[model samples]
Structures are given as C-alpha cells and as structure tokens.
Target: MESDSHDALDRRLVHALQLAPRAAFSRLAAVLGVSDQTVARRYGRLRGAGAIRVLGLSDPERLGEVRWQLRVRCSPDSAGAVATALARREDTVWVSLNSGGTEIACSTRTPPDRSDHSLLLQHLPRTPSVLGVSAHCVLHTFFGGAQSLAVKSGALSAGQVAELAAAGPRVAEPDGPVPELDAADRRLLAVLAVDGRAPLAELAAACGKSESTVRRRLEELAASGVLYYDLDVDWRIFGLRTHTWLWLNVVPSELAAAGAALAGHPEVAYACATTGPSNLHAVVITRSVRELYAYLTTRVAALPGVQHLETAPTIRIVKGPGPLPLSSPRDI
Candidate 1:
C-alpha cells in the first residue's frame, strides 16, 4: 500500500490513536467528524490488515531494567535463521535483518541484575553461524516508544490534536519515582503487550482481578509513565520505502543537542544515546534512496558535532512492536 491508496480518514484515525491509544471510539468519532461505528470499523480494518497495531509497552529504565541494541553479523546462509531465533525470544522487543541480510539488528531488554547472563553474553555466542556481535547499552532515549512518527503526518489540525491531548492520560514527570509492577501487574502487562486495546474484561481475566480493580491499576500505570502505548505500522503504506540506521559519533559536549535535533526530524523514527564508539543512534525512514541522500547531505550534515556517521540499511523486519507468537526455535 502507498500513501495515495489511503484516504484522509485513515491518516486522521492513525494520528488520533497515536495521541490517545485507548481513547473511546465515540471520542475519536467526534474529533474526526465521523460516526462511532465508522471510527471503530476503520480501526478494525487497518489492524486486521496488519498495517498497524497498538501495543502497551513498558519503559525498561523506569522499571529498573536495561535495554541493549545488538548488531549480530552472521554467515550469509544463516542470517535469516539466527534473526528468526532472536525474534522468538521473549526478551527481544524487535529484530530485523540489515545490511542486505548479513547482519541482524535487535533491541532487547534484561533485568539490571542479570546483565552478565543476558542472551547477548550467553546464547548468541554459542551460535556456530554467528561471526561477530556488538552490543550497545542504551543510555537514554531521546525519542521513541510512545513518540510516533504519525505525529508528523499533519493529518489532524492543531485544534483537534489539542482536544485529544486534553482527554488523554497524563504523563508523569520523568524524574518522578518509578512505580513497581507486582505479579498481577506483570500478568496484566503480558496480555497488553500483544494488544493495547484489549477489552477491560480480558485484562481482568488475565490478571485474575475484577474489572474495577484492573481498571484502577491500569490507570495508575499509565499515569506513572511505567506503561505507555505505541503503534507499529508498515512505513511503506505512508510512502516511506527506505529504512536506515544512523550510527553517529558526536563530541560528548554536543551529544544531547544532536540527539534532540535528530528526534525532531520527520525522517527519524527512533533516536537515542548509547554506550559505544558511536554514542548516538537513530533509525530513519525516507520515501526513496534519493530522498535519503538528500537527508544525509543536508539535515544530517548540519548536526551539532558529528564526527563520523555510518549508515546501515534494513533489508527486512523479522519482528515488530507487538509480541511474536510463542514457538520453538528452528534448527540452523
């Protein structure tokens, strides 16, 4: 699907969901000037087609966990198998084949106390086809997670955006105390990881709690910023065909400024600071190779203190924001 194939209503609905992932259908209908049934039906069609999905994800930093970006180089014949195996692991959030399918890029989370035993240190090293692995420990995220590229679509007017923002759940201050998720909370999150818009009754059942109790806990999690919603969409539908990763080395003094600047660019889908030779990392999506070149020569060249930059184009995405179905790893 391409941008011209979708109508204004589709874009508007997607933008609305980005602002308020769990907003009521009636509220969305009012803002979009459509019937409640229409809004719901549109959402259903988009989701059913696998063009988009809303997922409830947790902040690892807020939960006292660590996140890592792994670049695994594999033999030509084994890259796909290795990537598929990584995607099947519950610890991995997203995995993709990059650099013409010879390398795998994956984002994974691990408990802070178990860093030494993480999949990066233990499991990956044992794979016979693995040639090399580089792990970058994420230090800070400038943009991503709850921040969606849909925000740049310009589908919704400022007035409509403000109206929806006003009704959305309030985000707590970043420095505020982080809330702990108990067993019940973990169970609730497990179900939500697959479907953010899962019904309240379903959540209650998963957590083994009453609907009222589940509702209260859900509200608390969102308010505390421990849990937030994100959207996973096929960029091709929006006419974005080129997906590339930017590994940048910036002067330490200007790292924050450079990261913040990249985060504001429409082409940037994710940006963060990590502990590696390249301290800054970002994922950019453009409509074509020509547009990507323009972005690199213009916007990227103008960053504050970039010393070096390396671009890795993604070949295919093996996993996305939503959890993958449980399955055994295939033999390589």
Candidate 2:
C-alpha cells in the first residue's frame, strides 16, 4: 500500500513537470495541495533514484533538420558494440536494442545540408557484423514533441492539471528562419540538454553570460521551439510495463488518417509518419504481453487504412529521448 502511494505521488510529480517543466517547487506544491518542502523532497528522492529526469531537447523539425529512424540487424556478438557507437554520436537521440538484442533501432537528426543516408546506409552496412540496415526519414509527427506520455497516464486531477498548466510559459509557434546559435547559445544548450532545470547562475557561469542574458536567451530558444523539456519517467510507475514499436504500411492516400488514428490511442506513446515501405511508426506502452497481444488483435487491427503491421518488443533502451551532451562546432 505504501509503495502504491509513493508511486502515485511520483507520477503526479512527473505529470506536473510535464505541464510546467520549470515551475517552482512552491507552485507545484500549491497545485498538488502539498507543502513546498514535501514536493521538493519527493523530487529529490525521484531524481536520486533515477526513476525520473527532465531533459531539455532541441526540436529538429522546427529547426528544419532531418530526423531519421534507423534499424540495424547485426550479429548477436556485435549488436552491443554497434549500439554503443551509435549512442555515442551527438546526433543520435534514442537507441534501443530490440527483438532480443539482435536488432538495434535509433533516431538521428541532421542538418539540411547533411545527407541522412550516409551514416546508416553507406557506413553501417559495410561492417561485416551488420546484416542489414534500413533508414526511414520521419515525415510527420502525430504525437511527441510537447506531448507527454506521463500526462496521458492521467495521474493528476483535472483542476490540478489546469492550475499547473497555467503556471508555465505558453509554447509559442516557431516563426521565420531557424535561429543561428552563437558560441554562448551552444554552451547553454549543451548544459541544459543534461539538466533542463539548471539554476540561472550556473547557466550564466557555464555560458559566460550574465544571468539576465542567459534568462532571455533561454526564453527565446524555448519560445521558438528550438528547445523544450522532456520528462523521462519510468512507465512502470504508471502500471505500463511493456514497450513496443510498431511499423505500419498504409496507402499513401490514407497516411494522414492512419497516423491520426494511432495518435488518439491511449496505448500509443508517440506515432510518426515516415518514409520507406512502412510509412507509419508508433511506440506504445502496456501493462503486460497479454495486454499488448489484445491491443494488436483488436485496437491496432481496427485502425483504418493500415495495410501491414510489424511489432518489435524493446528489450532495452541504451539512450533516451534527450540527446547526449554535445561539444564542438560541428556537433552543436
């Protein structure tokens, strides 16, 4: 019973951050109806346990960058090394070992001038241990970005959520050309990529800027959709233990419908339209394999215009949604 209560509080706290990533502890406490110290203590415990974390991420799409999803089929002995190499790159955002660790799936972002195929197609396949490689360019994101799977877990009361949502800056739409980053901007992003809620003084010191300058730049980056926070919460805490990535092939004419349908499914964490034979990709969470089976047979089968579907169970996640801290002019 105590465990359940603790997990509930953790979920609420995570959801609160999703609503307002930079909210003060006192604000969170007011929305949660708890003391400020209690809220801070809970956050400390969760962070210490590595059960949840907040990371600032740059939105590649908003920056007019290309994001590609690559699947690598490698010999069992070489999969780990290949996955580690991919994760070490500053471009790769998420890396996962799937299908019992023989297959690796990762997402990488590149600037407009950089060809997306070179890394996965020209490089990876030449290696003897790699059997096959497929790179799918992400075309449309049905869900993800500002959407939080933890929020979909519905851990907070509607009133509380409304109050929390009102506490943060409203997300502004990206406009005009992608903003060019100066040296200080790059340094700021590098540090915030690791910890979104870093103190202003610390950020100022790292970026070699005044606190007010750092504050203004941070707001501009966030408002422009160049940066935002992602709360990496353990889905197990929300009673969703199983994770599966689904690839769907749909008729080109019905692609929008299929993507929209999957986005509305509660089991789906994120869904995107992509290039290749499988035009749609979705990540979903469930309580058990049995529940996953039911979703595949019933809910997934019911989606309109889905021509073919393939599911890969995520065995392990090596890197998460946030990009690793990056350095160097080219990497940033």
Candidate 3:
C-alpha cells in the first residue's frame, strides 16, 4: 500500500534523526542512501504532521533539577479538563491520559521555588473531581536521555553513528553542577528550545550576536552539558504499537539494584526510583500486546526485588517532551 511505503520511509528518517539530532541533510542523505532533496522533503512532511520534533533541551541533571512523576485519578467527566490544565504548567514536561482515560500521569521538573510538592499536596486534591494524587520524585534515572525511546527501531550502525558524531557538537553531561548561563546564553537557548536545527544566521539574529560567536557559545554549552537534544517521534509510526508505564513496589533495600536492572532492558525507555507506593516506574515500548506479554512474563516477573507491579496503557499523549500540544477546535 502507498501508505505503508510512506510510513516506512518516515520511520527510517526518524531513526536517522535520533542518531544525529542536528545532522545536515547531506549527511543524512548519504547515510540513508537517498538524495538530499528527498531527505529534506520527508523531514518537512513529518514536521508538518506533528509526528516528530527536534528540541534542544537543557539537561535537568546538569542543571541540578529533580524530576517528579505525578499520577492523578479523576472522575471520568473531569479527567480531560484536569489533564489539560496540568499540561499548561511550565514545570510539567510530559502529560498523558492513561489507564482507560480515568487517570492522568505526567513528569514535572522542580522549579526554582521548589514548589513541586504543592501540586500534589495542595492543588489537585482541592479540585472537585480529583479522587487521588501521588507524587514520586525521580531519585535516579537509569536509561533516560538522548537514547531513551530512540531504541524502538534499533540504533544506527556503529560506523554510521561514529560518522555523525564526528561531524557535529559533542555532548558531555556534567556530574557536578555547571555554572548558570549568562543573559546572552539564555537568549540563545530560548530560541533553540523552539527549533534545535535552526540556522546559524537565524540563531545569531535572535541572540544579537555574530555567527562565529553563537557557534562557539553553543559548543561551549553543549560541552559543559548545559544543553542536549531530544529527538521526538510518534513510536506508533515505527511499528511500536504498545506503550505502557510500569509501577513497581520493590523492597527498600533492593530499590537501587531493581532500578538498575530494569534500566538494562532494551524495551524500557526509562526507569527511575520514585517516592510513593510504587517506588519504581518505567516507560516501555513494544511491538504488540503479545510482545508486551512476553516481556512481562519472562523478563519482568523474574526481577529480584519486584514484589508487586501495575501496568497502565498510555491512551493519549496530550503533551510531549518539546512543547505543550495546543488545543484545536476539534478538541472542543
């Protein structure tokens, strides 16, 4: 089918982008063995469809920020509205409806004022339809970063990845706190947050700096681990039809070992320690329900510290990593 072929090309393009977030069309074309125009045209089409986006994101770890996973149970009638309102907050990074549409789950970063707990303790419980709220601080991240969900389609060949790495900015995630950026750096990051692949001239204009200066500063920020790129794509398009979040109750003594073990599984996009009934949470992608079944039975059930587990299917992705999804007339 024509649709099938188009979908195939789109998946390949997405995979290539994940390997090299800011690679040039020529580089991608050569790696994919297609013409440069074809690569650019396919990328434009995918962007127009809202199926993929490349964002220059600040690494939360490098910024000394904590990520918290929040789960809200609301009345069926008010679930959508409550999720939408939460998605609008600047601190919330990802939002989705899960578990048959009655529950909302999201990831939020701690703001400068450290008001993350207020969301669960004070705000949502006060809502008329919210039934329950839980906040789980992400104490550790095992398998999240640029390579998180990018594994669905398989990573590029080592040689191809090496080639792309040689051609662009190298990343170095800092272990200790990196100094905060200046005003000029902030302006540059603001623009890139919108469009990571923006042209150098355009970035310079936005920041009121010369191209050479902009390039140097961008490299410095990346080298210092202040900024990183996230390659977002609709996993369904790549034949990964099942997405689920797993919440695990692990023994306190083995929490770290359990989290580390979950992170090693290829199907797991990310695994982290939390602060609630489910002390561990992971995002997983699979090709089908059957595949997910096999993973749970053979792989997950066998983990040492996992005493109990719950799985919630992600029904709708209301907001993603880059920006909030805008509500259109159709939403009403």
Candidate 4:
C-alpha cells in the first residue's frame, strides 16, 4: 500500500515537472497539496536514484538544424561498443541497442550550414563490424522533446494542470524568426543540458556572466523557442516494461493526419514524419507485450492510412535524453 502511494505521488510530481520543468518548489507544492519541503525532498531523492532527470535541450528545428535518425547494424560484439561511441558524441541525442542487440538506433543533429551527411559518409562504413547503416532525415515532429508521455499519465487533475501551466514560462510563437546562439549562450546551454534546474548563480558562473544577465538570457532563449526542458524518467518505475519503436508507411496525402493521430495516442512517447521508406515514426511504451499487441490491433489499426508497420523492440538503452559523460573516440 505504501509503495503504491509513493508511486502515485511520484507520478504526480513527474507530471507536474513535465508541465513546468523549472517551476519553483513552492509552486509545485501548492498545486500538489504537499509541503514545499516534501516536493524538494522527493525531487532530490528521485534525481539521486538516477530514476529521473530534467534536461534543457535545444530544438534543432528552431535552430535551423537538421536531425537524423540512424539505424546501424553491427555484429553482436561490436554493437555495444559502437553504440557507446556514438552516445559519447555531443551530436547524438539518444542511443539504443535493439533487435536482440545486433542493431543500434540513435539520433543526431547537425547545423544547417554544414553538410549533414558528413558523419554518415566519413564513419561507420570504415568499421569492419558494421553490417549496414540507414539514415533517415527528420522532416517534422508531431510529438516529442518537451511533450512527454507523463503528460498522458492523468496523475494530476485538469485544474491542477491548468494552474501549473498558467505559471509556467511562455514559449515564443512557432513562426517567429529563428534566434542564433552566441558563444555565451552555448556555454549557458551546455550547463543546462546536464541539469535543467541548475541554480541561476551556477549558470551565470558557467557562462561567465552575472546572475541577472544569465536569467535574462535564459528567458530570452526559452521565449524564442530555441531552448526547452524535457523530462527523462525510468518507465520501469511506473511499471511500463515495454518500449518499442514503430515505423509506419502512410499515404503521403494522409501523412499529416496519421502523424497527428499518433501524437495523441497515450502509448506514444515520440512521433514524427521523416524522409524515408517509412514516413511516420513513433516510440511507444506499454506495460507488457500483451498490451502492445492490443494497442497495435486496436488504436494503431484505426489510424487513417498506415500501409505498413515495423516494430523494433528496444533490447537496451545505451543512453537517454541528456548528454553522456564520456568523450567521443577518434575511432570506433
């Protein structure tokens, strides 16, 4: 009973964070009906346990950058090493070992001014153990990043969510002009990428600026839609044991509707339209294989125009949302 209660509280807290990643503890406590100290203690415990993290991530679309999803096939022995090496690169966002540990899936972002295929052409092919590599350019994202699965948890009441949302930071209009990041902005973002809730003083120190300056810059970056916070939590903690990637080929005319529909599904963690054979891609989480089967047969089947579907179950996740601590190796 106590464990269940704890889990419920944790879920509510996580959901609140998803709505407002940097909201003050007092604000969270007010909405959660808990003491300020309780909110702080719970967040600290979760963070220390490696079960949850709040990351401030840059949006490639907002920065006029290109994002690619890479599927690398490797010998079983080399898959782990190669995935680790890829995860260590600052460009790679997340890396996973899939297909019984013979395949690696990762996402990388490149600046718009540079040739996006340089990494794909210059590396991986040279590695003897790599059997194949497929790169898919991400054209549009229907759901992901700041929009997390926690938002679908329904742990908090609608009124509570509205209260928190009202107090949260405002994001700029999507059609606004893209904002460029200077060296100081990059330094500040580097710190936030590791810890989204870092203190203002710490951010200022990292960026070599005053606290007021750092605060203003932070707000400017966020309001510009270039910087946003994301939550990384262990789904296992919530009894969500199955994680799978779904690649679907939808009729080009129905592509937008299909992606929009998938974005609204509770099982979907991320959904996007990409340039490849499979135009629509999504990450799904379920309690078990049986639940996944039901989702596919029912909800997924009901989508507008899914011509083909491919499910790739994740065997292991080498890296999650935030940056890895290791340095990139010269060779795999």
Ordered by TM-score, highest first, the candidates read: 1, 4, 2, 3
Query: How well does model 4 score by local distance difference test?
Result: 0.86
Native-to-model Cα distance after best TM-score fit, residue 240 in candidate 1, in Å: 1.3
Worst 10 residues of 1 by lDDT: 323-332
Highest-scoring model, lDDT: 1
Residues 178-197 of candidate 3 have per-residue lDDT tens digits of 76778878788877777788
The TM-scores of all predictions, comma-separated, are 0.95, 0.93, 0.91, 0.95
lDDT of 2 by residue, 241-267 (tens): 788889999989899998898888889
Model 4 ranges with Cα > 4 A deviation: 1-6, 325-332
Q: Is candidate 2 or candidate 3 better by TM-score?
A: 2
The ten-residue window of minimal lDDT in model 2 covers 323-332
Q: Which residue pairs clash within candidate 2?
A: none
Error in Å for residue 191 of model 1: 1.1
Model 4 lDDT per residue over 288-318, tens place? 8999999999999999988999999887777
Superior by lDDT: candidate 2 or candidate 4: 4
Candidate 2 to truth, TM: 0.93
Alpha-carbon error at 100 in model 1, in Å?
A: 0.7
lDDT (Cα atoms) of all candidates against the true structure = 0.87, 0.83, 0.78, 0.86
Model 2 ranges with Cα > 4 A deviation: 1-5, 174-177, 324-332
